[model samples]
Target: MKYISTRGSAAALDFEGVTLAGLASDGGLYIPESWPRFSDNEIAEMAGLPYAELAVRIMAPFTAGSLTEEELRGLCHAAYGSFAHDAVTPLVQFDQQHWLLELFHGPTLAFKDVALQLLGRLFENFLSRSDDHLTIVGATSGDTGSAAIDAVAGRERIDIFMLHPEGRVSEVQRRQMTTVLAPNVHNIAIDGSFDDAQAMVKRMFTDPSMATSHGGRFRITAVNSINWARLMAQVVYYFAAALQLGAPQRKIAFSVPTGNFGDVFAGYVAAQMGLPIERLIVATNVNDILHRALSSGDYSAGTVTPTAAPSMDIQVSSNFERLLFDAGGRDGAALAEQMRGFEASKAMQLTNAQREGASALFTSARVTPEEMVKAMRWASDHCGEIIDPHTAIGLYAACSMEIDAAMPIVTLATAHPAKFPDAVSEATGQHPELPARLGNLFEREERFDSLPGTYEAVRDYVAQRATESA
Candidate 1:
């Protein structure tokens, strides 16, 4: 259960180490050296298991000696018991063959809560014992900020700073982050796009001087899928979804809306673990670099166009490094060269081996803004089901692909439609009502730190917060 950096330079780490170190020091994501497999019996037993207990079963292998099965189960149950749904991630049959895995019934009303909630508790457990305080900085286009804030806010051992594109998120999305009054949480409205905010967060983490100057008193981490725990928790729903729909008997496929590639990458990890999945479809909006990469082997960033699905507007997909690590094509230097080339030139090419790796297990497709809205209408009109813009991209991408009657498909409904009220209302002719918990979001005053979008600027801001007394 050792984790190794994709770039092949950083020291191999264990589960907790990988969880705390979101991105590798070599600017790569950490991936498990070997995937853990579950017996058919274990998969069968997943039925009727509590969400937290299921998570422990699915994640125990990845954690190795970090926590025993019983300890992990306790942590997971404590974490998810507060969620809004009884089933945690419930399955709803949209049609006879197609189904929606409802993942938005948590505190923040996004699939992120499935993992971020547990991540917060894990951090509290690990950090409190060591008396080590953490400064968590994350960049989100939509749901990540709210989920991160909701989980980390008011915690004694951590201070969180989240950045989102100033004008890009929906009004509800922005308000969700802005209205939190937790003294330990801060939200930033970056002047540019989601990519800009993501880039800044990475720059801060990569700054060697920031770590040296922090005097070892302050630790920096992330809540994004860059965190291994986030990805680990996400992987459970994939297995649970497949099992509920008949996994070993019926091959399952997932259609995940692409952004930073974390969610889809989770399914990829599951496939590598020899889960009986048919296909892992990578769906996207106009920010379709991953889609293009899969279709034609071209990894190039087009302009980050602002769309109703702003969460998918990322040009730099972070979790792709893990895929490349397992893709089995090139050495570390060659992979590093490709990564640097993309960062510098905004484009990179996948070699034959790399392309084959992607082709082996994943398919890619893109949807336009117009198509997303249309599909939302079509799904609701034809099936009486409303989809959020992000989920709409996933639904259309899943539908547009050649229908394979051999396997049932599960589309990752990434966010609650209420998060994008305007887009959903326009497409479905009805606005989604927010959960009762979020009813007073507009009334709370938020606290946050703002800085220029640069490595030094953010590094200094993180340092200052880490020095603050709770």
Candidate 2:
């Protein structure tokens, strides 16, 4: 399967090329030239398969020409073998209508583990074929940094430099990234918001100076959702949840707590692949650029507001461009022009086509701190489940929507409650303890550096330390 950039200018790439090249050279995201659809029988055949087996079936189409089915299955099993649960991503019923898909079962205890674990292995497999070194530059709000770090730490032929906004993430979130002292892992605390760090990451991809620093053989890639492989792995869980809830004959709705838009866009990709999805609810916190854009066609970035849900404190939703490109008739040139304008002004209006296309299977809601806390309390009091703030926001939105009463809504439990103990404690009057598996996270020694949030600062830091390709 060939992947094409959202902007028309970049050469089309196969899955391996796209996996190694996170962002398109023309400042666009890569999407499959065409979505591979499954017949009803094909999707029905997927039911009851183990998570690893099911992953191979769903991802086989996308990984064509890069990995054999056996090779993909081996990677899937190896990646998921460390998950604490056999189900990998388990489902918990909250009530008659609402259920939670628990996705924090892996080593890092977040939904990102579902993909980054496999991504790290993919990097190892591909890089082993050649001596070319990969410098993975990524930006994270809370979860991505830790999950990505955990995945790639100590691996050969790879060095990861992850940047997070200093003092903006939860204590657990920060330590999860910083405590891992693997020589290949470099965590930088930037004095800015997630958007600033994300902007620098994106800029590094296009900056010629960055390429010059690494010399002839070094290539800079991404571990962020901008990577198609990461996003592609996320699509499997949607199928897992939907099939378990009776798909093919019955449609399922998912409520995703997303800040980067990658998680929910995976749902969009599942829907494109002919999964029987009734609706996808895009859940957001106080930084409601996604909510505003979906509801009123106003795609604009506002000032970052630090909240209990620090992960969602983002104004620029990077993956939103993928949706716009797909929904806006795949007119890359037009979308590129639109994006250029938005970049210059920090805002843009969604066209009629984009709005209409998105509204077909997508709905959105913005949750407030009060409502999020209320949901947390409701779950604890009524359902006997204590949830993290981000999951509570998704549950709040799921309850607020008026979907068919007979149909079930699954909220994506994005992180472990212990990761944000203070927020969970404040909301439900219950302090969550870290799982034994993550032993003494706070007590572990951490290594990282603080830098001003400038592209130049980040570029120089990475260039100085990143290994030159062999």
Candidate 3:
């Protein structure tokens, strides 16, 4: 299998190549050359397998030229073994119509651990075959920093530098990243929104001076959703949830609370791969750029509002470009021109093809704080479930969907309730206790740097400290 840049330019790469090269050289995200499809019998055979084995099967197509089945299986087992739950990503049924897919079982207590755990292993596996070392640069609103940091920290061949908006994240969210204290993990708290940090990270990927300052071996990769491998890893859970709920013979719907579009886009990939999906619900908080884009043709950015769900407080979603490129006829040049226009201004209207194609599979809703809290209360009172603010948005959206009574709607539980205990307590009148594994998180010594939100300041900081690849 080969990966092509969403933009018309950059050379095609195999799985390993794209895994190492996060963003395309021509300023586009990488996507598979074509969607890999499975027959009904093929998908049916995937039932009842363990999570590790299932991941190996679903990811085999994308990793064809890179990893053998045995190799991939070993990596999968090693990566998922650390999850607190045996199911890896367990599903909890609320009622006949609604369910929650718990994705915070891994070390970081966020959905990102599902992918970054395997991503860290992949980086180690690939780097073992060569002399090259990786300098991973990533930006996160909340969870991605901690998950990515936990994944790659202390690895001999990789050094990770993660940036997050300083005061925008919850106390648990911030400490999860700051308290790791790994020498190889460099955490930066930038004085801006997540979009500003994300823009700087993107700029670093293509900056000429960043490359020239270090030697020819200066290698920089990504841990964000901009990396195809990370997004590809996320696709397996959609299949896992659907197969359990009855798939191949039945269609399942998923509601994903996403700001960056990566998690929900994985569902779109599953549907493209012949998984029987009824719809992919794009759930957003007050920061509703994605909600506006899918509901109407308007894809515009506004000021980032600090929300209870800090992870969803993003204006510019990096992975939405992949959807636009695919749904808009895969005409890279045309999409590139369209993207350029959007970058110049902070807005663009989705084309007829893009709008129509997206509407066929996706429906979106924006949840206000009041509705979010109500959903949390409903879960507590009715279902005896304590949910984080992010999951509440998804559940509220799922309940609002006018779908068949027989159909099952799964809401992606993106984070642990303890991660946002204050918000959960305010809504449900119950303070969530941290799991035993993280009970002492607040007692750990924290370490990180504070920097102004400027491209040059961040660039110089990373450049001065980034290890030169050998």
- RMSD (Å) per prediction: 1.6, 0.9, 0.9
Highest lDDT, which number? Answer: 2
Q: List the residue pairs that clash in candidate 3.
A: none
> Which regions in candidate 3 have their CA more than 4 angstroms from the true location?
468-470
TM-score of 2: 0.99
What tens digits encode model 2's per-residue C-alpha lDDT throughout 370-430?
Answer: 9999999999999999899999999999999999989999999999999999999998999
Models ranked on lDDT: 2, 3, 1
Which 10-residue window of candidate 2 scores lowest in summed lDDT? 461-470
Each model's lDDT comes to 0.83, 0.94, 0.94
lDDT of 2 at 267: 98
lDDT of 3 at 218: 50
Clashes of each: 1, 0, 0
RMSD of 1: 1.6
How does candidate 1 score on lDDT?
0.83
